[model samples]
Target: MSVVKMKLNGKAVSGDVEARTLLVDFIRQYQGMTGTHVGCDTSQCGACVVHVNGKAIKSCTTLAVACEGAEVTTVEGLAKGGDLHAMQAAFKEHHGLQCGFCTPGMIMSAIDIVKRNGKNVSEDVIRRELSGNICRCTGYHNIVKAVQAGAANM
Candidate 1:
Protein backbone atom coordinates (compact mmCIF):
# COMPACT_ATOMS: atom_id res chain seq x y z
CA MET A 1 0.00 0.00 0.00
CA SER A 2 1.10 3.54 -0.70
CA VAL A 3 0.38 6.56 1.44
CA VAL A 4 -1.13 9.60 -0.22
CA LYS A 5 -1.74 12.99 1.32
CA MET A 6 -3.77 15.54 -0.57
CA LYS A 7 -6.26 18.36 -0.20
CA LEU A 8 -9.70 17.24 -1.35
CA ASN A 9 -12.63 19.58 -1.65
CA GLY A 10 -10.92 22.07 0.65
CA LYS A 11 -10.24 19.35 3.20
CA ALA A 12 -6.96 17.67 3.91
CA VAL A 13 -7.05 13.91 3.40
CA SER A 14 -4.51 11.18 3.86
CA GLY A 15 -4.89 7.50 3.21
CA ASP A 16 -3.20 4.25 2.41
CA VAL A 17 -4.19 2.66 -0.86
CA GLU A 18 -3.07 -0.16 -3.08
CA ALA A 19 -0.49 0.81 -5.64
CA ARG A 20 -2.84 0.06 -8.54
CA THR A 21 -5.79 2.09 -7.24
CA LEU A 22 -6.96 4.71 -9.67
CA LEU A 23 -7.74 8.29 -8.59
CA VAL A 24 -11.41 7.74 -9.42
CA ASP A 25 -11.55 4.65 -7.24
CA PHE A 26 -9.79 6.42 -4.44
CA ILE A 27 -12.15 9.39 -4.57
CA ARG A 28 -15.28 7.26 -4.76
CA GLN A 29 -14.46 4.13 -2.82
CA TYR A 30 -12.07 5.44 -0.22
CA GLN A 31 -13.08 9.05 0.17
CA GLY A 32 -16.77 8.26 -0.32
CA MET A 33 -17.03 10.94 -3.00
CA THR A 34 -19.04 9.47 -5.87
CA GLY A 35 -19.33 12.67 -7.87
CA THR A 36 -16.38 11.55 -9.97
CA HIS A 37 -17.88 8.77 -12.10
CA VAL A 38 -16.02 6.10 -13.97
CA GLY A 39 -17.77 5.93 -17.33
CA CYS A 40 -14.88 4.58 -19.39
CA ASP A 41 -11.90 2.86 -17.89
CA THR A 42 -9.86 3.61 -20.98
CA SER A 43 -9.90 7.38 -20.27
CA GLN A 44 -11.53 8.09 -23.66
CA CYS A 45 -14.71 9.22 -21.92
CA GLY A 46 -14.25 12.30 -19.78
CA ALA A 47 -16.87 11.14 -17.31
CA CYS A 48 -14.27 11.00 -14.57
CA VAL A 49 -12.81 14.44 -15.07
CA VAL A 50 -11.83 16.36 -11.95
CA HIS A 51 -9.64 19.27 -10.91
CA VAL A 52 -6.14 18.50 -9.78
CA ASN A 53 -4.37 21.60 -8.56
CA GLY A 54 -6.97 23.66 -10.42
CA LYS A 55 -6.51 21.77 -13.72
CA ALA A 56 -8.73 19.14 -15.27
CA ILE A 57 -7.58 15.52 -15.21
CA LYS A 58 -9.06 12.13 -15.97
CA SER A 59 -9.26 10.54 -12.55
CA CYS A 60 -9.56 7.05 -14.00
CA THR A 61 -6.29 7.45 -15.85
CA THR A 62 -4.40 8.84 -12.86
CA LEU A 63 -2.90 6.71 -10.14
CA ALA A 64 -4.01 7.46 -6.61
CA VAL A 65 -0.45 7.70 -5.41
CA ALA A 66 0.34 10.16 -8.15
CA CYS A 67 -2.00 12.60 -6.39
CA GLU A 68 0.02 12.65 -3.22
CA GLY A 69 0.17 16.16 -1.81
CA ALA A 70 -2.04 17.32 -4.67
CA GLU A 71 -5.19 19.38 -4.50
CA VAL A 72 -8.19 17.46 -5.88
CA THR A 73 -11.66 18.80 -6.51
CA THR A 74 -14.55 16.63 -7.64
CA VAL A 75 -18.04 17.57 -8.77
CA GLU A 76 -19.32 17.30 -5.25
CA GLY A 77 -17.02 20.10 -4.29
CA LEU A 78 -18.66 22.50 -6.71
CA ALA A 79 -21.44 23.33 -4.28
CA LYS A 80 -21.14 25.58 -1.29
CA GLY A 81 -23.66 25.29 1.52
CA GLY A 82 -26.20 23.67 -0.81
CA ASP A 83 -25.82 26.39 -3.42
CA LEU A 84 -24.73 25.12 -6.82
CA HIS A 85 -21.67 26.43 -8.60
CA ALA A 86 -22.18 28.98 -11.34
CA MET A 87 -21.41 26.42 -14.05
CA GLN A 88 -23.88 23.91 -12.64
CA ALA A 89 -26.55 26.54 -12.31
CA ALA A 90 -25.90 27.70 -15.84
CA PHE A 91 -26.05 24.14 -17.17
CA LYS A 92 -29.42 23.64 -15.55
CA GLU A 93 -30.73 26.99 -16.70
CA HIS A 94 -29.57 26.25 -20.29
CA HIS A 95 -30.64 22.59 -20.40
CA GLY A 96 -27.17 21.28 -20.83
CA LEU A 97 -27.88 17.78 -19.52
CA GLN A 98 -30.01 14.82 -20.54
CA CYS A 99 -29.49 11.32 -19.07
CA GLY A 100 -27.01 13.13 -16.77
CA PHE A 101 -24.28 10.50 -17.02
CA CYS A 102 -21.84 13.03 -18.44
CA THR A 103 -23.09 16.12 -16.66
CA PRO A 104 -20.55 16.01 -13.84
CA GLY A 105 -17.54 15.77 -16.08
CA MET A 106 -19.00 18.24 -18.53
CA ILE A 107 -19.50 20.77 -15.76
CA MET A 108 -16.02 20.11 -14.41
CA SER A 109 -14.47 20.60 -17.82
CA ALA A 110 -16.63 23.60 -18.58
CA ILE A 111 -15.67 25.30 -15.35
CA ASP A 112 -12.02 24.84 -16.17
CA ILE A 113 -12.54 26.06 -19.72
CA VAL A 114 -14.27 29.25 -18.65
CA LYS A 115 -11.78 29.80 -15.89
CA ARG A 116 -8.93 29.48 -18.33
CA ASN A 117 -10.72 31.65 -20.85
CA GLY A 118 -13.37 34.25 -20.01
CA LYS A 119 -16.97 35.38 -20.55
CA ASN A 120 -16.33 36.75 -24.03
CA VAL A 121 -15.51 33.23 -25.18
CA SER A 122 -16.98 32.21 -28.53
CA GLU A 123 -19.12 29.21 -29.48
CA ASP A 124 -16.42 27.74 -31.68
CA VAL A 125 -13.93 28.27 -28.87
CA ILE A 126 -16.20 26.47 -26.43
CA ARG A 127 -16.68 23.61 -28.90
CA ARG A 128 -12.94 23.29 -29.29
CA GLU A 129 -12.41 23.48 -25.55
CA LEU A 130 -15.02 20.82 -24.96
CA SER A 131 -13.55 18.48 -27.55
CA GLY A 132 -12.16 16.21 -24.88
CA ASN A 133 -15.53 15.80 -23.22
CA ILE A 134 -18.19 13.76 -25.06
CA CYS A 135 -21.89 14.37 -24.54
CA ARG A 136 -24.10 11.86 -26.41
CA CYS A 137 -27.43 13.30 -25.32
CA THR A 138 -27.43 17.07 -25.89
CA GLY A 139 -25.70 16.99 -29.32
CA TYR A 140 -23.62 19.97 -28.04
CA HIS A 141 -26.15 22.64 -29.01
CA ASN A 142 -27.40 23.33 -25.51
CA ILE A 143 -24.06 22.31 -24.09
CA VAL A 144 -22.44 25.17 -25.95
CA LYS A 145 -25.15 27.49 -24.73
CA ALA A 146 -24.61 26.34 -21.17
CA VAL A 147 -20.90 27.01 -21.36
CA GLN A 148 -21.47 30.43 -22.84
CA ALA A 149 -24.00 31.27 -20.18
CA GLY A 150 -21.80 29.90 -17.48
CA ALA A 151 -18.91 31.92 -18.82
CA ALA A 152 -20.97 35.10 -18.77
CA ASN A 153 -21.68 34.74 -15.07
CA MET A 154 -18.13 33.77 -14.19
Candidate 2:
Protein backbone atom coordinates (compact mmCIF):
# COMPACT_ATOMS: atom_id res chain seq x y z
CA MET A 1 0.00 0.00 0.00
CA SER A 2 1.12 3.51 -0.70
CA VAL A 3 0.52 6.37 1.66
CA VAL A 4 -1.08 9.32 -0.10
CA LYS A 5 -1.64 12.76 1.39
CA MET A 6 -3.58 15.68 0.01
CA LYS A 7 -5.84 18.59 0.92
CA LEU A 8 -9.41 17.37 0.66
CA ASN A 9 -12.12 20.02 0.78
CA GLY A 10 -9.74 22.41 2.54
CA LYS A 11 -8.74 19.76 5.07
CA ALA A 12 -5.62 17.67 5.10
CA VAL A 13 -6.29 14.00 4.51
CA SER A 14 -4.10 10.92 4.24
CA GLY A 15 -4.77 7.29 3.63
CA ASP A 16 -3.09 4.06 2.60
CA VAL A 17 -4.20 2.82 -0.77
CA GLU A 18 -3.13 0.31 -3.35
CA ALA A 19 -1.00 1.57 -6.19
CA ARG A 20 -3.84 0.83 -8.60
CA THR A 21 -6.50 2.57 -6.56
CA LEU A 22 -8.48 5.16 -8.41
CA LEU A 23 -8.97 8.64 -6.96
CA VAL A 24 -12.70 8.00 -6.76
CA ASP A 25 -12.10 4.86 -4.77
CA PHE A 26 -9.77 6.63 -2.42
CA ILE A 27 -12.24 9.46 -1.89
CA ARG A 28 -15.35 7.34 -1.54
CA GLN A 29 -14.07 4.13 -0.01
CA TYR A 30 -11.07 5.29 1.94
CA GLN A 31 -11.93 8.88 2.77
CA GLY A 32 -15.63 8.03 3.29
CA MET A 33 -16.88 10.79 1.02
CA THR A 34 -19.67 9.16 -0.95
CA GLY A 35 -20.83 12.35 -2.69
CA THR A 36 -18.51 11.52 -5.55
CA HIS A 37 -20.53 8.88 -7.35
CA VAL A 38 -19.34 6.08 -9.63
CA GLY A 39 -22.00 5.89 -12.30
CA CYS A 40 -19.66 4.50 -14.92
CA ASP A 41 -16.31 2.87 -14.36
CA THR A 42 -15.26 3.51 -17.97
CA SER A 43 -14.90 7.25 -17.33
CA GLN A 44 -17.54 8.04 -19.97
CA CYS A 45 -19.98 9.08 -17.29
CA GLY A 46 -18.98 12.18 -15.40
CA ALA A 47 -20.48 11.04 -12.10
CA CYS A 48 -17.08 10.79 -10.52
CA VAL A 49 -16.00 14.32 -11.44
CA VAL A 50 -14.09 16.32 -8.85
CA HIS A 51 -11.79 19.29 -8.61
CA VAL A 52 -8.12 18.42 -8.38
CA ASN A 53 -5.91 21.43 -7.80
CA GLY A 54 -8.74 23.74 -8.86
CA LYS A 55 -9.48 21.87 -12.09
CA ALA A 56 -12.20 19.43 -12.90
CA ILE A 57 -11.19 15.82 -13.64
CA LYS A 58 -12.81 12.43 -13.88
CA SER A 59 -11.87 10.81 -10.62
CA CYS A 60 -12.27 7.30 -12.00
CA THR A 61 -9.59 7.99 -14.60
CA THR A 62 -7.19 9.49 -12.02
CA LEU A 63 -5.00 7.57 -9.59
CA ALA A 64 -4.96 8.33 -5.88
CA VAL A 65 -1.18 8.17 -5.65
CA ALA A 66 -0.92 10.59 -8.53
CA CYS A 67 -3.00 13.06 -6.49
CA GLU A 68 -0.60 13.10 -3.59
CA GLY A 69 -0.08 16.71 -2.36
CA ALA A 70 -2.88 17.86 -4.65
CA GLU A 71 -5.89 19.83 -3.55
CA VAL A 72 -9.06 17.79 -4.03
CA THR A 73 -12.59 19.06 -3.75
CA THR A 74 -15.59 16.79 -3.91
CA VAL A 75 -19.27 17.71 -4.10
CA GLU A 76 -19.42 17.84 -0.35
CA GLY A 77 -17.01 20.73 -0.30
CA LEU A 78 -19.23 23.02 -2.37
CA ALA A 79 -21.43 24.06 0.50
CA LYS A 80 -20.30 26.36 3.27
CA GLY A 81 -21.89 26.68 6.71
CA GLY A 82 -24.81 24.43 5.74
CA ASP A 83 -25.75 26.56 2.73
CA LEU A 84 -25.65 25.19 -0.78
CA HIS A 85 -23.23 26.57 -3.30
CA ALA A 86 -24.61 28.93 -5.90
CA MET A 87 -24.59 26.17 -8.51
CA GLN A 88 -26.32 23.80 -6.17
CA ALA A 89 -28.96 26.36 -5.29
CA ALA A 90 -29.51 27.08 -8.95
CA PHE A 91 -29.90 23.38 -9.65
CA LYS A 92 -32.58 23.16 -7.01
CA GLU A 93 -34.39 26.27 -8.20
CA HIS A 94 -34.24 25.25 -11.84
CA HIS A 95 -35.04 21.60 -11.31
CA GLY A 96 -31.84 20.60 -13.00
CA LEU A 97 -31.82 17.07 -11.64
CA GLN A 98 -34.31 14.22 -11.76
CA CYS A 99 -32.75 10.93 -10.74
CA GLY A 100 -29.96 12.87 -9.02
CA PHE A 101 -27.24 10.36 -9.90
CA CYS A 102 -25.47 12.83 -12.17
CA THR A 103 -26.14 15.95 -10.12
CA PRO A 104 -22.84 15.96 -8.26
CA GLY A 105 -20.71 15.63 -11.35
CA MET A 106 -22.89 18.04 -13.24
CA ILE A 107 -22.51 20.62 -10.51
CA MET A 108 -18.74 20.19 -10.34
CA SER A 109 -18.34 20.46 -14.09
CA ALA A 110 -20.69 23.44 -14.28
CA ILE A 111 -18.64 25.30 -11.72
CA ASP A 112 -15.50 24.73 -13.75
CA ILE A 113 -17.24 25.84 -16.91
CA VAL A 114 -18.35 29.06 -15.30
CA LYS A 115 -14.90 29.63 -13.87
CA ARG A 116 -13.32 29.27 -17.28
CA ASN A 117 -16.01 30.87 -19.43
CA GLY A 118 -17.10 33.55 -16.96
CA LYS A 119 -20.62 34.33 -15.68
CA ASN A 120 -22.08 35.31 -19.06
CA VAL A 121 -21.85 31.78 -20.46
CA SER A 122 -23.98 31.29 -23.51
CA GLU A 123 -26.38 28.40 -23.93
CA ASP A 124 -24.50 27.00 -26.89
CA VAL A 125 -21.23 27.21 -25.02
CA ILE A 126 -22.65 25.54 -21.94
CA ARG A 127 -24.04 22.72 -24.08
CA ARG A 128 -20.79 22.30 -25.94
CA GLU A 129 -18.71 22.33 -22.79
CA LEU A 130 -21.00 19.88 -20.99
CA SER A 131 -20.50 17.16 -23.57
CA GLY A 132 -18.59 15.10 -21.05
CA ASN A 133 -21.40 15.01 -18.52
CA ILE A 134 -24.47 12.97 -19.48
CA CYS A 135 -27.78 13.20 -17.70
CA ARG A 136 -30.42 10.59 -18.52
CA CYS A 137 -33.15 12.71 -17.03
CA THR A 138 -34.07 16.40 -17.55
CA GLY A 139 -32.65 16.23 -21.09
CA TYR A 140 -30.16 18.97 -20.17
CA HIS A 141 -32.55 21.85 -20.72
CA ASN A 142 -33.02 22.55 -17.04
CA ILE A 143 -29.41 21.75 -16.37
CA VAL A 144 -28.36 24.40 -18.85
CA LYS A 145 -30.64 26.91 -17.24
CA ALA A 146 -29.28 26.04 -13.86
CA VAL A 147 -25.70 26.43 -15.03
CA GLN A 148 -26.44 29.82 -16.49
CA ALA A 149 -28.19 30.99 -13.40
CA GLY A 150 -25.49 29.57 -11.18
CA ALA A 151 -22.86 31.24 -13.29
CA ALA A 152 -24.55 34.59 -12.87
CA ASN A 153 -24.67 34.11 -9.12
CA MET A 154 -21.04 33.07 -8.96
Candidate 3:
Protein backbone atom coordinates (compact mmCIF):
# COMPACT_ATOMS: atom_id res chain seq x y z
CA MET A 1 0.00 0.00 0.00
CA SER A 2 1.12 3.52 -0.73
CA VAL A 3 0.38 6.43 1.53
CA VAL A 4 -1.10 9.36 -0.43
CA LYS A 5 -1.77 12.77 0.98
CA MET A 6 -3.59 15.74 -0.59
CA LYS A 7 -5.86 18.64 0.10
CA LEU A 8 -9.42 17.47 -0.47
CA ASN A 9 -12.11 20.14 -0.63
CA GLY A 10 -9.84 22.50 1.27
CA LYS A 11 -9.05 19.92 3.97
CA ALA A 12 -5.91 17.86 4.28
CA VAL A 13 -6.55 14.16 3.72
CA SER A 14 -4.34 11.08 3.73
CA GLY A 15 -4.98 7.41 3.21
CA ASP A 16 -3.23 4.16 2.40
CA VAL A 17 -4.10 2.80 -1.02
CA GLU A 18 -2.85 0.17 -3.40
CA ALA A 19 -0.50 1.38 -6.10
CA ARG A 20 -3.15 0.62 -8.67
CA THR A 21 -5.94 2.36 -6.78
CA LEU A 22 -7.87 4.88 -8.84
CA LEU A 23 -8.44 8.38 -7.51
CA VAL A 24 -12.19 7.79 -7.56
CA ASP A 25 -11.71 4.67 -5.44
CA PHE A 26 -9.56 6.55 -2.99
CA ILE A 27 -12.13 9.32 -2.74
CA ARG A 28 -15.11 7.01 -2.42
CA GLN A 29 -13.54 4.18 -0.45
CA TYR A 30 -10.81 5.75 1.64
CA GLN A 31 -11.95 9.36 2.00
CA GLY A 32 -15.64 8.39 2.08
CA MET A 33 -16.63 11.05 -0.45
CA THR A 34 -19.21 9.47 -2.72
CA GLY A 35 -20.03 12.57 -4.75
CA THR A 36 -17.49 11.65 -7.40
CA HIS A 37 -19.43 8.87 -9.10
CA VAL A 38 -17.84 5.90 -10.80
CA GLY A 39 -19.81 5.42 -13.98
CA CYS A 40 -17.71 3.68 -16.61
CA ASP A 41 -14.45 3.02 -14.68
CA THR A 42 -12.98 3.79 -18.05
CA SER A 43 -12.47 7.41 -19.05
CA GLN A 44 -15.36 7.45 -21.51
CA CYS A 45 -17.90 8.57 -18.95
CA GLY A 46 -17.41 11.92 -17.25
CA ALA A 47 -19.27 10.94 -14.07
CA CYS A 48 -16.05 10.68 -12.14
CA VAL A 49 -14.93 14.21 -13.02
CA VAL A 50 -13.25 16.23 -10.28
CA HIS A 51 -10.95 19.22 -10.03
CA VAL A 52 -7.32 18.38 -9.44
CA ASN A 53 -5.41 21.56 -8.73
CA GLY A 54 -8.29 23.61 -10.18
CA LYS A 55 -8.49 21.62 -13.41
CA ALA A 56 -11.12 19.02 -14.25
CA ILE A 57 -10.04 15.41 -14.70
CA LYS A 58 -11.53 11.93 -14.71
CA SER A 59 -10.84 10.55 -11.27
CA CYS A 60 -11.60 6.97 -12.25
CA THR A 61 -8.62 6.80 -14.59
CA THR A 62 -6.28 8.92 -12.46
CA LEU A 63 -4.15 7.14 -9.91
CA ALA A 64 -4.47 8.16 -6.28
CA VAL A 65 -0.70 8.22 -5.87
CA ALA A 66 -0.44 10.59 -8.82
CA CYS A 67 -2.68 13.04 -6.97
CA GLU A 68 -0.44 13.22 -3.90
CA GLY A 69 0.13 16.84 -2.82
CA ALA A 70 -2.53 18.10 -5.23
CA GLU A 71 -5.64 19.98 -4.27
CA VAL A 72 -8.70 17.99 -5.19
CA THR A 73 -12.21 19.38 -5.40
CA THR A 74 -15.20 17.11 -5.72
CA VAL A 75 -18.81 18.09 -6.27
CA GLU A 76 -19.25 18.35 -2.52
CA GLY A 77 -16.75 21.21 -2.47
CA LEU A 78 -18.66 23.39 -4.96
CA ALA A 79 -20.94 25.00 -2.44
CA LYS A 80 -19.91 27.34 0.33
CA GLY A 81 -21.74 27.18 3.64
CA GLY A 82 -25.20 26.00 2.46
CA ASP A 83 -25.58 28.03 -0.72
CA LEU A 84 -25.26 26.30 -4.03
CA HIS A 85 -22.46 27.13 -6.44
CA ALA A 86 -23.48 29.22 -9.42
CA MET A 87 -23.40 26.25 -11.75
CA GLN A 88 -25.41 24.11 -9.35
CA ALA A 89 -27.96 26.87 -8.90
CA ALA A 90 -28.22 27.30 -12.65
CA PHE A 91 -28.72 23.57 -13.09
CA LYS A 92 -31.55 23.63 -10.57
CA GLU A 93 -33.06 26.77 -11.98
CA HIS A 94 -32.86 25.53 -15.56
CA HIS A 95 -33.90 21.93 -14.84
CA GLY A 96 -30.68 20.61 -16.33
CA LEU A 97 -30.87 17.24 -14.63
CA GLN A 98 -33.47 14.48 -14.82
CA CYS A 99 -32.10 11.18 -13.47
CA GLY A 100 -29.40 13.13 -11.58
CA PHE A 101 -26.73 10.45 -11.97
CA CYS A 102 -24.60 12.75 -14.10
CA THR A 103 -25.37 16.05 -12.43
CA PRO A 104 -22.30 16.27 -10.21
CA GLY A 105 -19.83 15.68 -12.97
CA MET A 106 -21.75 17.87 -15.34
CA ILE A 107 -21.61 20.71 -12.85
CA MET A 108 -17.90 20.22 -12.26
CA SER A 109 -17.15 20.16 -15.96
CA ALA A 110 -19.38 23.14 -16.60
CA ILE A 111 -17.50 25.12 -13.98
CA ASP A 112 -14.26 24.28 -15.71
CA ILE A 113 -15.66 25.30 -19.06
CA VAL A 114 -16.77 28.63 -17.72
CA LYS A 115 -13.43 29.16 -16.04
CA ARG A 116 -11.61 28.57 -19.27
CA ASN A 117 -14.02 30.25 -21.68
CA GLY A 118 -15.18 33.06 -19.44
CA LYS A 119 -18.77 33.99 -18.46
CA ASN A 120 -19.85 35.00 -21.96
CA VAL A 121 -19.39 31.56 -23.46
CA SER A 122 -21.63 31.01 -26.45
CA GLU A 123 -24.19 28.24 -26.89
CA ASP A 124 -22.25 26.56 -29.66
CA VAL A 125 -19.14 26.63 -27.52
CA ILE A 126 -20.98 25.26 -24.51
CA ARG A 127 -22.43 22.38 -26.51
CA ARG A 128 -19.10 21.66 -28.12
CA GLU A 129 -17.31 21.68 -24.79
CA LEU A 130 -19.91 19.44 -23.14
CA SER A 131 -19.23 16.58 -25.55
CA GLY A 132 -17.46 14.63 -22.83
CA ASN A 133 -20.38 14.58 -20.39
CA ILE A 134 -23.41 12.48 -21.31
CA CYS A 135 -26.91 12.72 -19.89
CA ARG A 136 -29.32 10.06 -21.15
CA CYS A 137 -32.45 11.66 -19.74
CA THR A 138 -32.28 15.37 -20.59
CA GLY A 139 -30.98 15.12 -24.14
CA TYR A 140 -28.59 18.01 -23.34
CA HIS A 141 -30.92 20.88 -24.28
CA ASN A 142 -31.51 21.82 -20.68
CA ILE A 143 -27.97 21.00 -19.76
CA VAL A 144 -26.73 23.37 -22.42
CA LYS A 145 -29.03 26.06 -21.17
CA ALA A 146 -27.86 25.47 -17.64
CA VAL A 147 -24.23 25.72 -18.63
CA GLN A 148 -24.77 28.93 -20.53
CA ALA A 149 -26.74 30.44 -17.67
CA GLY A 150 -24.22 29.17 -15.16
CA ALA A 151 -21.44 30.70 -17.18
CA ALA A 152 -23.16 34.06 -17.04
CA ASN A 153 -23.40 33.82 -13.29
CA MET A 154 -19.81 32.74 -12.86
lDDT, each prediction? 0.91, 0.96, 0.93
- Candidate ranking under TM-score, highest first, comes to 2, 3, 1
Q: Flag regions of model 3 displaced more than 4 Å.
A: none
Give each model a TM-score. Answer: 0.97, 0.99, 0.98
Better of 2 and 3 by lDDT: 2
The TM-score, computed over Cα atoms with residue i paired to residue i, of candidate 3 is 0.98
RMSD of every prediction: 0.9, 0.5, 0.6
lDDT of 2 by residue, 18-48 (tens): 9999999999999999999999889898999
Put down candidate 3 lDDT per residue, 1-154, tens digits, no spaces.
Answer: 9799999999999998899999999999998999889888778779999999999999988999999999999999989999999999999999999989999999999999999999999999888888888787879999999999999998
Where does candidate 3 have its weakest 10-residue lDDT segment?
36-45
lDDT of 1 by residue, 1-154 (tens): 8789899999999889998999999999999998788887898889999999999999999999999989999999998998988889999999998989898999999999988887788998899988888888779999899989988988
Note the residue pairs that clash in candidate 2: none
Model 1 bad stretches (over 4 Å)? none
Task: Choose the strongest candidate by lDDT.
Answer: 2
| TM-score winner between candidates 1 and 2 | 2
lDDT of 2: 0.96
TM-score of 2: 0.99
